[model samples]
Every structure is written in structure tokens, then in C-alpha cells.
Target: MVRYFDAELETMPWTDVLAWQAERTATFVRGLVDRSPFHTEKLAGVGVPTGVVRDLAFLEDLPFTTKAEVRESQSTRDPALPLGRHQAVPRGAIHQVLSSSGTTGQPVLYGLTATDVEMWADVIATAFWTAGVRPDDIAGHLVGLPGVAGGLPYADGFRRIGAGLAWIGGWPTERVVELMISLGVDAVLATSSFGTYLTDRCEDLVGIPAKDIGVRKMLGGGEPGLGQPEIRQKIVEGWGLDVLSEIMGLGDVLACLWAECEDGGGMHFCGQRAVAVELVDPATGEPRAWEEGVRGEAVYTTFAREATPALRYRSRDHVLVTATSCACGRTSPRIRCVGRTDDMLIYKGMNVFPSSLRDVVLQGFADDVQPSIRVWKDGSDQVRFDGPIPMDVEASDDLAPDRYREVAAAIAADVRARLQVRVAVTVVAPGSMPRTAYKTPLVHVRETDDDQ
Candidate 1:
């Protein structure tokens, strides 16, 4: 039988959820207007009555909260408010603080009250349970970066679910492997790339493939690409996993919001109580309905938060709704994150994500190339490539150096035929490209000799 962390909320009727969210949002907005200076002014500027919203209908009227705005608010350095002008509670009430990875810009700090911390733990536990983490399993965590939500907050969530936890991240890979084997870790929590990286490292270090290390389950998060078919196939085969589920969240909102169930076509909405989620056109800021095949950016309102309450926060993540109903009995919609808006590239008016190109190369040319690739950019800010985009792919171990040109030609042709976009493919030697234990970036800016 399929199990849920909270069956009542997970299987609630969609119409009933709408009513619950509306009521919670109204009360949450009133508190935000009274306590948060940034939100109060923003809501008033949009002509919300008394600078407070009374219902979910006003969500569209409320201005979006952007990362730039949040960063600017904190830049003020007001002595009274360390968390920023948007902080909904006093500094003393903040029980803990976490930060973003700052991949796009400066790392933004988030505050959580004691109660908020408990709520986040529950949210993450619920997500993990949905992803098939059982209480009896010993989960070896590889997401222990300091002060990030993926670090301690996730560890707490693991324990809350009554699972055996070993916080093994931030250590050297050799040490991580040693401990996993010694402790007989059967389940793993890691970034998607790390899962693939560990597969290779295990064989190289211990002369044993990761599959032999006894790990039967893997939950990948903290980055995209885990849901891609090629990546998923690699990880599942590499680790010999019984189940592989993808979990996604943003630091600006709840840490673990969407999780894939065992029936998994995509990750179901798992943060309904803490966040009121909306799908909207990224360009037009217009709301989109939650229907299968619908594509849009995700926007979140943290209506149940205390330390910091986000009002209509715009998350630049672009996703496609894959299913409206699951055999697993989840009533919420399921989604697969397509790509981030900032990571999108335009080639001759056609939009392309680097992850998509990676998928085509790995899936179509698996024998000729390694699973790694890097897209070369003209500059750091270049998003539009006028010519065939420059990309480097590593050759497979069995592929000879002299045959690189043939493989390159085949890959370029395949990418063009599949994605309908031109890519300049250069097959490099195996291990020539960089790999990371954390998130792996697909794009690399050309470095000048002077900089080198």
C-alpha cells in the first residue's frame, strides 16, 4: 500500500484545499501588513485596502517579490532588522538563519522562528516520506553544506521521519565512501550530480561499484537534471537503485516543496500547507491553471511562515505539469522542472536549455561519448548564440582519439535533428571536463589567457 506522511492533507479534495489556502492566506497577509515594512508598502502601492489583502483573489494584484528586491532590502543594513525590511518578526524571535547558494547573485539570508523551524522540518519530512524514505532505513546524507536549507534542516527532517541519519557531506569523497560502506548505508540523500559522481568514485576508490555498497534508494535534489531521462538512467544503473525519486525546492520558499512518489512520472506538490503555489506566465505575469501539459513559472506565497513571509514570490523555475492525478492517490498536481529562466539560451529565436542538449547527447550517443558535457559561452552574460553553439563532450573509454571527429559530427547532427538547434560539438578526451561533488553547471565561459 502507498503511504503518506499526512494523508489528510495529501489526499484532500482540490476544492477543499482552495478554501483552506484562501483562509490561511488572508490571515497571513494581515500579519504581513502589520509587521513587514517592505510588504506593507508594496501592497499599498498596488492599492490593496489598508495595505492588507483580505483574500487569495488579491494575490494577482500584489506585486511580485524578486530576488533583487530581497537582496536590496537586506542591503539597507537597518540595525533594528538584520533579516531585512521584509522580516515579519523581531530579530530576537528568529531561531535560525539559512542562505541561498547565490549562484545567480549575492546569497540572500532567510530567517526562521522556532515554530517556523518545526514547520519546515515537518514539510521536509513529508516530502522525504513521499519520496519513499522508510523509517527503518539508514539514510546517508550528502547535502550538509553549512547554513543552507539542504544541510541541517534536511538532516532534522530525516530524523523526524525516524530514519537513521549519517550527516556525511562536506567531507572528502573518499571519506564519504568509507563511512557509507562501514555504516552499511542503504539510502542516500544528495545533489543529482553527486549521485553520479559517487558512482564513479566508489569503483575507483574501493574497487567496488556503488551498487555493491548496499544503497537501494536515492533521493536527488538541490539542482535540476535529476528528472532528465539520460541522467536518471545513469544514476539508476550506476547505483543499482531500487527506487530513484526527485525532490525540488527553493530557499526563498519552503526547502522541500515537491517530491516524486514511487509511481513517479513527476514530483507532486508537497508544501500545500506552508506555501500557496501558483503557475504563471514568466513573461506576462498572468496566472495559469493547474492542468496537465500546462507550462509556466512557479510563484509561491509563504502564508504560514512567521519569521519571514513572502507575498507572491516569483520563482524563476520553469516547469511542465505532467499529471493531475496519480495512482499513488495524491490529489495535488505533479510537475517536472524544465529549466530555469536564467539558464535558458535563445538560438535563432528558438529557446533551449543546456540540460536538454545534454540529454540528447547522452541518450543518442551513449556509446561514443561520456555522460559529461560543457557548453562554452562567449561571455558570462551571453544568453543568445547567433551561430552554432560551442560545446565540448568527453569521449567514451572505448572510443579512440582518431574517431573523435566522426563522433562529434554524429552528435552535432543528432542535436540538430532532435532539438532543432545547432550545436558546435567538440569531443574531448575522457576526464578533460570538470566535475563537482555539488551542482554541476552545464555552461562554461571562455577564459582569457590573461585571466588564466
Candidate 2:
């Protein structure tokens, strides 16, 4: 198996990596102060010391860059600088422009210079390499290619390892399955939900189990369910995958920034040279210690980026630091994304995450339920629920109607017992709930102002 993409750097001491990143950040900050008006004004407002940032600790005093600020920067961008005020270089310097999925609100655009593109390839390749991808493997690329970061950037990174790539996204399901067979594709790159959905799709199309299709590996990302025990079991069993790993990235930062290693614990930080990561309390925004089992929001600052670099970017990606060291010999930390701060809810003086609730149900009642669930919301902006939070769960195909009450009661009890949150379980018939070939929504807004 491919171990480290760049062994010397990947296996470097954690202390040395920080020192290297600190110096790079210092130089980048000095350049940003001169070039980026956005960074300059923000830094000036906070009264940051005038000069190069000499250490990583200097980041704490810097103002956090939010998604709102980025959107505003883009919307109010000068005509000459279309990529936003964060655009440190001229438009001509940007060789490519990528965008976010915009599932939350308006999509944000990011610019990449020629150097940024080459660095991105190396970063993404390191992620894939950590996930056990080898040079000879033929990977079926299933994610849709558009203006999004996961498009050509990811494909280019995968090919950097001398792996064969089949761009089969946006094609019909049957056609995709056919190419997988003909091209001898042994690995698949896809969103977690899409990977699970394709397992059933391939079986239906070929009249055989997906495991028999010669695909032995799955690299799932774009969502968090793969880390859940129930979801992981489903994808592993359905695909008969020998190597199942999850990758995570932020569009505003870098693509495939964290990747799971073959040792199978959590994703290791893969963008160390390009990005500095910090753990901060989501509630207070205070810096959290990088100890194992500590949960906090992941904050990122991009250095060595030419076109658009973010300093102390508030990623809002809440994660659990899994380990400070790994058996894979990489010195960077490991993490598992629990949920986003935006997706978190407040209940009866306790903070709750919908993904955690789903994990409770799927882990406790995996046999009776289909692996599909959604928390029902009375309004789009609803966060605090006075009553038992409404949730809908789809029954598995073999689950009987008579056992619905038993299963539902057990699920409610288990959720309350485990998460200390009350949930009103509404078990629906099999196939009633929606399943997607993309990122799955954990919360379903039942009432919107427009609908009302």
C-alpha cells in the first residue's frame, strides 16, 4: 500500500511542522498586509502588530474570518477584482476559479493561481495516499464536475499518484455501472450517500451484488455519515469494500484537507504545509487544547496561497480531535467531524447535534430501520424546540407493521437515554423516506414561510 505521498514532510516531527508552518504564515501575512485590502482592513481594525507574524500564537489575536465576510467581500467586490477583496493578486494571476456547493445560502467563489493549483494537487494526493490509494488502481470518479472544488481539482490529485481515472459522473446509473465493469475500476471516489446508493444501483443494473462487481475500495466524503457506525457498516457490507475511508474538506479553505488513513481510526490532517488548523470552542470561540477526545470547531488559516488566502478562517466545522499520533507514522493530528455549528440545536439547556441523534437511532435500531432518517422542523430557522423534537425514520423492508410500536418506543427510549434529549419518533413505511445520490440532509424543514 502507498504510505506517505511525501515521506520526508508527511513523517516530519509535529514540532518541526509547526515551526515550518509558522515561518510560512509569517511571510504570507506580511504579503497579505501589503496586497489584500480585506486582510489589511480587518487586521487594522483589530490593531494587529505591524510586521510579520512570528509565531502561531499570534493567530489568536487576529480576527476570525467568517463565511459572511467572504460572501460580502464577493458581493461588494471591485469590478477589477472579481474573486473578492480577498483576491490578493490580479485577475490575470488566477488560473482557475472554484465554488462551494451553496447548499446553505449563496455560493462563495475562490480563486486559484497556477501555483495554487499545483499545490492543491499535492495536498489532495497526500490525502488519497493516506487513504491507501496506489498508483495502479483505477478509480471511478462519481462526483459531478462543475465549478465546484471537488471537480477537476480532485481528479487531478488522484491522477498525480499514477492512478487511472474514469470521469463517469453525471452519466446514467446503468452507464456508470457499465464503465465500472469495462474499465476494471477497483476503487470509487464519491460522496458517502452516493456511494451507498450506488451499491443498490449497481446490483439492480447488473443483477448481482455490488461486491461481485470487482470494486474493492471506496473513498467517501462530502458528508459525515460514513463515520457513523451504522452507516459505515452499510457501505462496507453493500460494497464489500476492503478499503473504506472518508475524506473531508472546506471549499473556502482547501479540498480534501483531512483524510482517513488505512489504519482506520480517523482522518489525519493532510494540508499541514498549506493550512494551519486550530481547535476552538464553538460556543465561546476560545482556543481549545489539541488533546485526544477534545471536541471543538476547526479553524483554518491558509498560507502559501497566492490568489486568495484566508487568515484565521472560521470554518465552523466542528470536529473531535481523535489522536495526536497515529500508527501510520504521520505526525499531524487526527480528527472526525461531528457536525457543524450551524447545524447544532439547543434543547432544554443542552446542545444537540442531529447527526448524533441519527447515530443513536441507527446504532440502536439498525435492524428495524432502513438507515434513512430526518429530524422534522416546524420552521426553517427553528433551533430551540420546547417539545420532543420530531423525527421521521423509515422502516426497513423486512420490518413488520406490528413491531413498529416496539421499535419506535425502543428508539425513543434509547435516544433519550443516550443523548439526554427527547425525540418523538414517527416510523414510516419502507421506501417512504427520500434517499439521495448526493449529500443527505439530516434535518427536514416541515414548514417554511413560503409554504405557509
Candidate 3:
């Protein structure tokens, strides 16, 4: 059965939704001008009108918000404005301050007001409900430390919805499995790689197959694995779970903003009332219509925020938007993240994402290759490469050492045939590559020949 946390907002008419967004956006812009000195200075000559922004086209006139800009704002150490001018609320009113995961570059700090906290909880709760998590289910959250931005919101949202949460962030795979058995956990929250890692270790740790565990639904995010058909199928078949849903969000904008419903469609925009989304051509910076198969970078603007509100915040996450109504009866748009713009590699006039390459390898090799993989370039800071990119694949335990060369050759040939990228695949023994509790790094570059 399909359940909605906020049925009125989730089921609101499409036209009404746009109207609400326009009204809220206008108010939010006005508040930014009044409360945020950084936005006030940045938007000086943009000349945005005062009233309701009835059309999204007006947004193009305003300057785009980038991660660099936010980082710069946070770096300013003026005593009067220690939290940066982008902060909208007073320091006393700030309820919580969080930092980005710093996976790409320097981590930016964000503060949330009391009201912003509630809104964040609501957005996460709606995402959880859409992912088929109910109040009666015990959710085991596998995320980073509680202080990180990615995991804390899930804990708060689960508590808000009256679901029992087992905080197992630092637990080993064996302990996690043991807890699932003892606590009767039916729902789990984890990144795709962590889920795969736990599944791979289940039998060795607990003396039972992963499928024997009682987890019914798996909520995967923090990376691109769950959305890929090959990776998702591996988790579904490996864990013996009935449903798998993907949840996506940004720390700078909102957490758990989009989530997949039970029908397994792409993640729906669950933060319709609180956030407005736009798509723009990554190369040309031109706005694109939110239509099926139209791909671009995601830009977000928050309407009802106090501590740190952003306008036209560039997410750098390339996605294809779908306007088709989902089977779950949500009128909001859905998105499938294609790749991060920073992670794109251009080789011989073709663009490739490492995640896509990993998916192709998984689909072709199945159980022969372990989920752990690393794509490497010969030189450091090299964005573009020509032929025969280097990759290291961890061979499964059951694969014989004599067959390593054959398996590596097959994987390289499959990648060439399917993804049109040439790669030199090296099959290493199991546990050669490092495993991560958070998002896995798909690309690794050796700084110098000596290091290699």
C-alpha cells in the first residue's frame, strides 16, 4: 500500500504546486535580501522584483550559487559575522550546525534554526514513508558518525515518525548482523556500497546467509549504486529483500529531499513546499524544461528556511528529470542522478562516469568480481585520458587463481564493448582494495610514477 506523510502537499494539483513555489520563492528572496548580507551583496545588480516570482524564468536573472561561494563566505573570520553572512538567523536562534562530508573539497558549515530543524525532519519523514518504511518497523541506520551531515537527519526523521531506531553507525558488519537478528529490524538505511559489503560478509560473520536476515526494505543513497539496475539487482538478490528504494539529498540544500516510492520508480521530489528545483545545462548554463529524458545539473532554492537559505544553489549532480506521473500518485517530478559533473571523464570525445563503468562491470561479471573497485589514471590531477585507462578489480574468493587472467580480460573486453571505454583491468585477490563505511571513492589517481 502507498502511504504519504503529507497527503495534501504530496497530492496537490500541479498548477497549485507551482503557485505555491512561486509565492514561497518570492518571500524567501525578500528574506535573504533582508537577513543575509552575503546574498544582499551578491544580488546587488540583479534587480529581482519584490512581489511573487510567478515565473521560474525570473530566476535566471539572479546569480548562481556555487560551493566555492559558500566556502568563501564561511572562511571569513570577522567577529561580528563568524558563521558567515549567508547565515540568516542569529547565533542564539541556531539550533544545530553541521558540516559537509568534504568528499570533494573543503567542508562548508551550515546552521539550522529551530523551524529549519522541524522542516528537515518533515522532509526526511516524507522520504522515509515514501520508501515504504512504517512506524512499526525497526530501522537500522548504517551511516557515518552522528556528527556528519548525511546520517543525523535520518535518525531524527525516524524518531519523528515513531519508528524504533537502532543506532548502528560504528558497528562492524558482524555486530550489525547480530543486532538485526536480535532487534527484529525490518528496514535498513545505508549507502549502496555498505549494503553490498554487509551482504558479502554476512555468512562469514553470522554463520547465515544474508538472505536469511529479516530485513524487508532497504533504503540506499549517498551514492549512485542503487539507481543502477545491475547494482540494485545484486543487492536485491543478495539480501533477499522485497523492496529497494533510493533517497537523494544535498547537505547545502536539504536532506532526504527526493525518495523512491514502492513502485521502484526514480526518486520523487518530496520537498516540494520547502524547496524549489531547477535544471540547467551544465555546459551552457541555460535552463532546461523539466521533461522526461532532459538531462542537466540540479539547482535548488529553499523557500521556508531561516539559518542558511540558498537561491539557485548549484548541486553539480547531473540528473535526468521525468515529468511522468508515478504509480504512487505523486504529482511532483522525479529524477535519476546520472553522475557528478566533477567526476566526468572525457576520453576520445566520449564522456564516461566511473559509476557507469562500475555498473557495466558488475552487470557483466556478476559474482566473479567483488563489489570493491577503483578506477585509476596514471598521473595526478588528470581529468582527461585517452586509451587503456587503468582499473583494479577485486576477484571473488571462489574464483580460482588460474582463471584470473581470463576474468580480467573478459571484464576489460565487456567494458570496451558496452561503455566504449578502453581499460586495463588488473584482477587482485580479495581484500586488496580498501572498504569504506561511507561513500566509496570510485576514482583514484597516483600522484607520481614513484608512488605507482
Candidate 4:
């Protein structure tokens, strides 16, 4: 049998992990101010000296940074940071740059020092071991986009494990189906939402269940569908694969991975290399202290990273960090994401989570209740729910509009009554809204009469 796991990283002792992170965190913290200009300004603002953080506790005293700050810095600074005091390594050895494009904000560049690159490869190698990828298995990456540069790590990981690859980036639906059919693909890395879309569409293009296409496992990412049990079941039912690994991280897939171990539990983190995560409250912004059942943000500090390394970067993700020991005999930290910091729609005082809305919609409807929601910038919201109902008043069209109205009203009432917020109800025909290859966004914004 293939090793299927990196014994060195996965089985490292927990005591040693603490020591390792302490040393690296100290070094990284000391360098943070000079490395990025944002941190330098931040240090100046707070009247705190750089290169002063000696350990983990010192991090808490530092002011928290946000995505908005990063964006502002990227706008005015030297477009490309020159090789100077900020440079992590000598100029001659830098091989590749894996930076965020600020699709959401101003793009900040994070370079990978040569050492950072090697560690990244090993981490990725650890990630792919989930698929039981060996020298013999064939792997493919379908959604290797322009930024985030996921293809390289995958290729490097595959090479490290002696696995063969098809080198096919994420393709159009039709092309994806043909390549899988042609190459006899063994493992695939694609977004979870796209996987389901491909499975459903593949049947129409070719009469084959996506599961029967020789893929043993899938590495899913790029959205919130990774940990959703409903979507997970759908992907399995549609594709027929046994293993669906959920990896949650930024564009730099190497930064982190929540790969499922042989056990059926949620994803597990590798503690051997480095990870200093502080799960903070979604509302109050305080560390949850690994509370058993509370949600918080993920502030990550990866000590193993050298090039463009981060110290306590806020991932804008919410989850309950568990200290419960895993049955897999690995003492590494484990995280189960409950929702996203950005995904939550805050209107009128109450926080409405998209995952909560999705769960309610999915469980409450069996028919084509094309569930769609509309939110307004003015802080008002509406929901359009379309599902078949019982025959209460079949004889008159009064019942038609009223029944539809009642259904929408009932959902609105249920949400208001339960979630404690009011929402306008608009009923529509089945198959009204559009679905995308990836997770659907809440695209509609309701406008009031004054604006219209």
C-alpha cells in the first residue's frame, strides 16, 4: 500500500510543535515591521517598536490588522517592492512569486524564498497524500486560475510522491469531461461547487456517472461548499466517489490545508511545520480561546513560511477550533469551518449567515423552490422562495397569487420569527434564478420606491 501520508509531519509530537512555533514565531514577529511597509506604518501608528515580539503572548498586545489596510497600502506604494531591507532573501535565488491580486482589495505581493518554496512543496506533498496519490496514480488540476497559483504546488507535490500528472488546468465543462474520459484521471482538484455542476452536466454531455470515471478522491476548494454536508452528499451521490477532501485556504493553497484523514471527521491541520491560529469572536473580535462550541475568526501565523510569510493574518473565516484529540493518533490542530466572516450578511442588528439561509432553504424544500434572496444597500432585504405546495385553493386564481404569497410570507415569517428580522417576500416561478459553476452569490439587491 502507498504511504498515503507524510509520516514525518503528520506524526510529529505535539510538545515539539510548540517549541518549533515559538522559535519561528519569534523570528517572524521580529521581522514583520521591516518586511511589509504596511506593518511598518502600523507599528508607527501604535507607537510599538518593530523586532520586539519575542514570543506568542506579545502578538496579542499588537493591534489587529484588516484587509482594508492591505488594500490601501498596495494602492500608493512602489508597485513592486525593490530588493532592500524588506527583502526576505538575496535577489539572485528567488524562483517564483505567489501573490494575491487584491481581487477584493489592493493586491499585496508575497514572495516565496527558496526555503519557503521547498517547505511549500512538502506541505503540498502532505496534502495530496490524502488521495493516496503515488508514483502510479494520475492527478489533474481543473481550476488552476491566474492568481493563487495552485498548479505548481500540485505538480511539485505529485512529483515528490512520484505520481504522474495530466497537467490539465481547470477547463470548460465540455473539455473537462473529455479529458477525464480520455486520460483516465485518478484524482482531481477542483472547487466543490464546480464538481457537482460537472457531475450533473457530464451526464448530459456523456452518459457516465461522474463517480465511475476512475477518480478515487477529490481535493475541493475555492468556496464555502467544502464543509457543507448537504453539498458533500450531493457531490458523492452525483459523482459516486468515496473520498471528497475539503481544503480551505487563500489563493496560496500552500499556506494551509484542512485535509481529511482516513477517519470520517472534518479536516485536520499539520502541526509539524507551523500554524499559530487564534479563533476570535465574529462580533466582539476577541479570541474564543478554543471554546468548545463558539465561533471565531482565523488569525493565522505560519512559521514554516519564509518568502512573503504572514504573522497572524486574518483569514475572515469563522470556525470552532477543537482541542479534542483525534482518533487518527495525530496531535495536530483540527478546524471545522462553520461559516465565513465575509459571507455573513449584517442587516438591521441581527447577523444573517448565508450558510444558515442555505441550510434552511435546502431542508425546507423538496420541489423546485428556486431559493434566491435579494439584499439592498439601504439595509432592507427580500427573499424569493418557489416550491410546490399542497392544493389548498385550486378552483380560483385568487389562491394562485395568495398561495404563492402565503408561501413566501410563511418563509419570511419563519425567518423573521426565528432569525428575528423582517424580509419582503416575492414569489416566483420555478427555475427562475440562475446557477453558476461555482457557489451562487446573493446577487440581487432590492431597491425602494425612492431610489426607483
Winning candidate number (TM-score):
2
Q: Which should have the higher TM-score, number 1 or number 3? A: 1
- lDDT by residue (tens digit), candidate 3, 271-304: 9868988889998789988788889999999888
Worst 10 residues of 2 by lDDT: 45-54
* TM-score-best of 1 and 2: 2
Off by over 4 Å in 2: 45-55, 447-452
lDDT string, candidate 4, 1-452, tens digits: 74436676566665555555666676666666676556666656443334544345555766665655544544553424542223445445566765663444445555666677677767777766753456777777675553455656557767776777777675667677678768988778777767767665666667777877777777776666655565677777777776778766563325446666666456667534655666666666676664445567877776666555555667777775655456776666666776665556654656766666554544454232432333333332332222221111111212354467666666666666666655555656433444466555543444669778
Best by lDDT: 1
Candidate 4 clashing pairs, residues 3+ apart or interchain: 113-307, 135-162, 142-170, 143-170, 211-239, 369-386
Candidate 3 has a TM-score of 0.92
Superposing all C-alpha atoms, what RMSD in Å does each candidate have to the true structure?
Answer: 2.2, 2.0, 2.5, 5.9
Residues 258-306, candidate 2, lDDT per residue (tens digit)?
Answer: 8899887789999987999888998788999888999999998898788
From the highest TM-score down, the ranking of the candidates is 2, 1, 3, 4
405 Cα displacement, candidate 4 (Å): 5.8
**Where does candidate 3 have its weakest 10-residue lDDT segment?**
48-57
lDDT of 2 at 223: 80
